[model samples]
Target: MRAFFKAFHYAAKGIVHSLRSERNMKFHTIALIFVTIAGLLTGLSITEWMIILILFGGMLSLEMLNTAIERVVDLVTTDHHPLAGQAKDVGSGAVLVFAIISAVIGLIIFLPKWF
Candidate 1:
């Protein structure tokens, strides 16, 4: 239990640090704000709003993961390294996957309404 608490504390600190130093974290925060506002104003039913919320969260979660991978890679390898490059690439691929999934969800939600 103590170990779990310590790990949780460590992760919380890392998240706070990332929010401070990462441009992508700022972008994600701004995006989250906009999405929350839109969801509030759009008069969505509970189910629809839940879907939007999930999609919004999934992107942010993936971004955090990508940030974690990059930070860890940089920590381990200060200079250029092939394995470091692959680690970053995999992290980027995770972001791309989430972004594409979110885009599809957005289209599904907004396209019919717009048309």
Candidate 2:
């Protein structure tokens, strides 16, 4: 039980660290805040809410993972290696892809109600 609790604590710490250090993480967090406010004002249906929540989880998790990958790559080598650059680029690309998908989903859910 204590170990499980400690695991949660470590996870929270990692989240805080990433939010502080990663610019993209901060941007995603800001977007999440705006989307949450819009979700409230738009009075999302249960299904829509679920979809948005899932998007939130996916986007944030992917961003954190990308950050982690970049950090690992940096730590492993400060030298300008092609593989390292490729790893970081791929991680960033993954985050970008997910962000675009999440934005599209948000628009799909909100646009009809807004316009």
Candidate 3:
């Protein structure tokens, strides 16, 4: 009980920190809010919501991972190592891939109704 609560508290703190400290997280969250509203306006069914939620989650999770990777790379090699730079760039590329795929999915899901 106490142990579980402690773990939950730390996890909640990390979530709050991530939401506050990460600009990409902020953008993803704002996008998700607008997408949710659009989903409602477009009259998405529950299944559609499930799919959208999955894609959104994938994008957000990948962004977080990219942030983590970049931070680690910076921490290890703050003096401009070429390999570290490549690592950071690769992580960013992963985030870009996820973001683009998610955007395409969003357009596919939402455009038909609006058009």
- Give a tens-digit lDDT track for model 1, residues 4-106: 8999999888778867888887887787788677667666678878888887777767878888888889888899999999999988898888877877877
The reply for model 1, stretches above 4 Å from the true place, is 1-8
The C-alpha lDDT values of all candidates are: 0.80, 0.93, 0.87
TM-score, structure 2 vs. true = 0.95
lDDT of 2 at 68: 87
How much is 20 displaced in model 1, in angstroms? 1.9
Q: Which model scores highest in lDDT?
A: 2
Worst 10 residues of 2 by lDDT: 18-27
Candidate 3 overall Cα lDDT vs. reference? 0.87
What's model 2's overall lDDT?
Answer: 0.93
Leading candidate by TM-score: 2
Clashes of each: 0, 0, 0
Q: Per-residue alpha-carbon lDDT of model 3 for 39-98, expressed as tens digits?
A: 988899898899899988788888878888887887887698889989889988998988
Model 1 clashing residue pairs (backbone): none
Q: Compared to the true structure, candidate 1 yields what TM-score? A: 0.80
What is the descending TM-score order? 2, 3, 1
TM-score of each: 0.80, 0.95, 0.89
